[model samples]
Target chain A: MSARVFINEVAPRDGFQIERDFVPTAAKIALIDDLSPLGFAKIEATSFTSPKAIPNLADAAEVMTGIQRQPGVDYVALIPNEKGVERALACGTDELNFVMSASDSHGRANLRMTANQSLERFEHMVALADGHNVFINASISTAFGCPFEGEVRPERVLEIVARAQARGIQGVTLCDTTGMANPRQVASLCAEALSRYPDMALTLHLHNTRGMGLANAFAGYEVGVMRFDAALGGLGGCPFAPGASGNVCTEDLVHMFEQMGVHTGVDLERLLGVAEQLPTLVGHDVPGQVVKAGTSQRRYPLPDAIG
Target chain B: MSARVFINEVAPRDGFQIERDFVPTAAKIALIDDLSPLGFAKIEATSFTSPKAIPNLADAAEVMTGIQRQPGVDYVALIPNEKGVERALACGTDELNFVMSASDSHGRANLRMTANQSLERFEHMVALADGHNVFINASISTAFGCPFEGEVRPERVLEIVARAQARGIQGVTLCDTTGMANPRQVASLCAEALSRYPDMALTLHLHNTRGMGLANAFAGYEVGVMRFDAALGGLGGCPFAPGASGNVCTEDLVHMFEQMGVHTGVDLERLLGVAEQLPTLVGHDVPGQVVKAGTSQRRYPLPDAIG
Candidate 1:
């Protein structure tokens, strides 16, 4: 591995949902369409989650149908159950992401099931996806640390990964659900999983909860984690987790990696332009710093700047 | 070593200089007075830089003399040149920090000189401090990435470190003057420097400009770096760098270290209390998130939080 990485853009789905106002499905499609040309390998287009659960993304179907797809981009969606999967599959989802929390409290509050039951349900979801030739990504939410459990054991994460692997899932995403992860924890879990399961592909879905997302992403990169999840302008949060933050900003992460000579196949300037479009679309100040300050390497000579 | 780290608070000097309003010398003294009991080994009390250059801290002498110093806390001052040193020593300073840029362009923009010239002057400054009983810390600004030069070589950093060693300064602080450091860059430089000069202590001064400050701090930690520069409430940036950001937030860094069983010897809540006072004192939201969100571990249950 020559340190190649994959970037998954989730701004359209998770980022849009966090906004206080309802961003129209056409706007969501347009945003994803603009990002389509960027070299993101996967764009999680929308979620087939219940409207009541996340009212902001109520028109997930319209977003999925309306986007103009780029040739090489993998547009995916988050599906909660058989019904959501049916809807996503009906709408021609190329990739399906099924999420279940590792914590029992979260599993219940989120999915109305225990971890074991969620795993059993995931088996059915995987079976459903196998029939459609759709790749299923098992995202174990709150895998690093949960708001309820406080400290989630690695054994639990490994257990979930093992089960996720057993179902022949395409990959597993370790999410810092409430953004309770530091670099040490991110390094340990991702390294342990990748080491133990050589065949299992691991991805990181990070939140900037304590401002450790990019660092955690870098730590994973150090351990040969090339695939990651990010949102444009750092949009998205666990709406349930009050005081929690948005995901690692796509532009910021790409800017950091591209500057470091890590090839992410993403266009930095284009991403920045895409990010600048969001504030007006969403009617609020988005929480990204890179778009605001410009890249650190970006500078004009003082004389020229004055000129 | 068991990761017992030392956080040198540079908010008063580094944080205040970039800030436009002149924080009263009385407030500067009171900040140090209030912070004296927080178990910090060193507090950068004030800068004796050209008051004409940075008029905000013109009363550097008043602040240096007025702080209620605890017995062991070493009050350090930033010395731009020999003149700054003479002024600081007269005000009863125990430690002196001399800064120079690693890149010629930034050096010119910053200190109105070249890199070679700055390094040469550091030797003379160190000699001046030798018999004066003042501890000299040679801070190489823009060591990670230069605002003018895109990437800074680690060999150049080592060369500057070697100069600091030749002058027998206390140690060298590698400042990410524009907050453009990554974990790998931080790790490699620290490892190489520590290997070459085992006796000289290494400190990493980071900026959250790219949101990798804490990660860079940890990268330094993994490679046996124990001394770090953090501003209370994340309140500092280099004015010379166009898009520079604040240093690593003190409370955030302390929180990470304390949680990892890495003893910083600094109280987390007590540090947060200090951070909380900054908004009222600074009249703006200082960048420390822990003040607004509480510690990473401070999770609120909905039942308790709703009321």
Candidate 2:
């Protein structure tokens, strides 16, 4: 139990971003408010992207302002540029997340620019947020394996990391944008990235697309990487990224890690309760397990064996 | 590439065993017939157990005789006792899969006998099948963790394996009865089990309850355990195991092994074709990703490029 794990809840930003049905601002606030008391270290509240881009999250500011932020919880918001950063700043977010794709193909498809241009844009956004108490984290999408490109090389991922470090970002998350990575790929890339930038905060963001989400997360843990981003209710996927299942389910990751004697600081039972509301919320059965199947300890009494 | 990889196709037996909706015997035969051409060296076709317990598979005899048997494919079936063995033998099957539980509680619950009684019955079943020209595979269910007993000690698993050896059973599959195993537990247990019984054909049958199914498979693979049991479209779970999500999705496992260059003889495209029918068949979206999301070589074009 000496292991302390960071659980970064990404449901509001990543989960709501990809969901088909529009969840009202009140529901979004209620979801975050419901999760705030669960001992989570960080909860990504919402994204400041254009309403036209992610229509479901059009009321991002309302959700951000409405939620009751528990003491010691860091409420972060996803910001794309100077404008989005300004919006998140007004919402009083404690942290700001800026995402840019690593692969040129993904960068073009996702961000409408070349890799270098995305890097330059991230630098400008970081500079704009200077002197604020807001902590900045730059995430690279498709860092593991891109659908547009069949294989992602580690050097390409390293190049993105070096660029992020140069921009004075405090942290970075290597994302398997399309979930095409195996454990070997995850081990190789994360080991290299963490070794090269030991001081930078690193996290693994993954989808259960090919069913390697938890495995890849373990690979990160084995390589001495902690701080993973997951969505409650198994809510996430990039519409642009092919083979994208939902993000690794929050309760499933919590269940696996907490059972393994890793301290995720997450309340498993509460998370499962929140996850139960998702199917009705999104109008589809989600891809998380612990949420549907209660913990092993939460079992019904069995009948006695007959002679 | 020199690694020995074996696949135990449980689509016929485990796949259809838990379904409420009946697949016609003709369709079941056609499914197995279609799978035989895909280079599966071994396939578990049906269970010869009493139909009183599992009515969906009452027509086991018809399934064994109806399918177009491919040359070199070891067609196996489940047998509980002498009567089941006689039926499997009469059908001219190639392999006999006799399952005994590792945990006493699960043993009695599933087989209506104590652990020792199950082993004693297995000895008789093996003796009766001697000179019957059927390959014997002894599977130990609840080998990882049992729903009844909180944690099934690996020592108990080794005990079951030793019993199978004494009874002259040629192979053994260690199953996670309630999908309650993590990768470290999976690897450590497989290593411990493999060390004691190196010559016994070792296979792992996993459930995806906690989302660690493929990770557990990889852990077992890392420990030099090759053979694995999987179902198409994640379509199976023990009815007795409350809240067990389903068996490991066959295509997901195939995707991992094939990506890492471990041969399993499954074509992803062909497997996805089978998976595409799952939603229509089950009347809901099955918990599989590769079928809905194309392979890496395949990708959907996305707009709004940064690169």
Candidate 3:
């Protein structure tokens, strides 16, 4: 296993998109700017989807332009089609994230099309942005299993990746949209994906819906995956999938990996300070454990009376 | 690996003991009876500690005597001293659980005695109950690490196990008192314990204080551990330890294991129904993931509008 791993912070986009209340553009910019220097390999700054689909992210263009840029950080924006691509490119997004479901039922339910049609739409976006300097990354949602469809085949995901690869996409994230993955399943699928696409940079976007998110991440790590996508305080989940909870918490994931001797290079205390502010901003408690319970290394003083 | 594993339910004793409001004796019995037929290998019915110490469990004797017992189910009780042993034997508990800290500072702080002193007290109880038809299980709390004293050596746990083994104890529970255990640490210590005492049965009692409860359990399971302790709704924590959260949730643990094709023999639906009742019982939301997110295999219907 590598001594260091990379975390792509997705709370500003993935987390905030699911909230009912629209966070102010200034607040979104401030949170992203606060996280810019926290040693994140990538920051999913905002999404270029229509305001009608996600009104919370309507100020995406302003937030994208407002945040102070760090030198080494890759600022990413989620884009669905050619229109989103045009918007993201106009804002000078460092990376554009395209997504489609591996399960046809999920694709139909989520994107109003089949998997092939979504891939074709992605191809159109890729063809339209041919001269742009930005990198393109694809996410296969419900890659492990889908709520609408009981099980998703690995071959289907591979087929989607093959299409993305043909369109010159270098990275793909396999998302457990409802957190239905087990460790052995994760190990086997990740191993299979690596075997089939040796050069494609793979990242796992897991949710803590069933509390197996970190376990799945560890299994993926054991099988040689070095990149993961997480949200601050486990912020987001698919609204369409019933019983789906939050994404894996960034601070919690970093704490676990760092405790296991893998370096994240992110200051946990500072990250925790940011996570602590999430409840007040979002108006409810978050699902992250490390925020309520401090890191394991925190010590307690002995009782004075010893009763 | 075995197809089946044993989960010892500790909610009644471990979870209820920490609550500020005392659960009624009849209610405790009702919950235990409800859990009796849900396929738990063992249920820690109550603790026979002094009423003055833990007023929440002051009705331990009544709760133990009132529960409806199921065939093949081992109903256990926690016993802190000779007085507790006497009370437990009177209630006809199948197993008497004894506890000692692996760290001397924790031992002094929790039990008001040294580790050696606690072991001697256990030996006296063994002699006093020589002819009794009951099993003895000792838990070495802070086996992984201690909040009062940092980094408890594995040798300390080994030493306690040796003493318990010499006194004819059938099993030993290595508790992560403050949930400081990582996967590597659990794997190494469990391997060493098995190597040193090949015939003695080992069980892991982990806390989810740092959100590593299931990960630690998986590590232990990988290293030949077939038994674990968990509370329903993830509803227990150390009263003395600051920032301590709940124990690993029984429904969540069984959910993960069952999803991985490991048979826990726990009925997920029935267990969930019981877990659903806990929020009202405790007057707060639980920490269990499955209670909120449902099982990984749970399917959702496709949206009619798909908008």
Model 3 docking category: medium
* Maximum-lDDT candidate: 3
Estimated TM-score per prediction? 0.95, 0.94, 0.97
Mind giving the per-residue lDDT tens digits that candidate 3 earns over A28-59? 99999999999999999999998987889998
- What is the C-alpha lDDT profile of model 2 across B31-67, one tens digit per residue? 8887887767788999998998778788999999988
Residues A18-102, model 2: lDDT tens digits:
7778888888888899999997889998889898877888898898889998999999988877899989988888999998888
What DockQ does predicted model 3 obtain? 0.65
lDDT of 2 at B303: 54
lDDT of 3: 0.88
Q: Against the hidden true structure, what lDDT does model 1 obtain?
A: 0.83
Q: Please compute the TM-score of chain B alone for each predicted structure, in the order given.
A: 0.95, 0.95, 0.98
The model with the greatest TM-score is: 3
lDDT of each: 0.83, 0.82, 0.88
Predictions ranked by lDDT, top down?
3, 1, 2
Lowest-sum lDDT 10-residue window in model 3 chain A: A237-246
Query: What ranges in model 3 sit over 4 Å off?
Result: A242-244, B242-244
lDDT of 1 by residue, A238-278 (tens): 85566556898898888778766788999888889989988
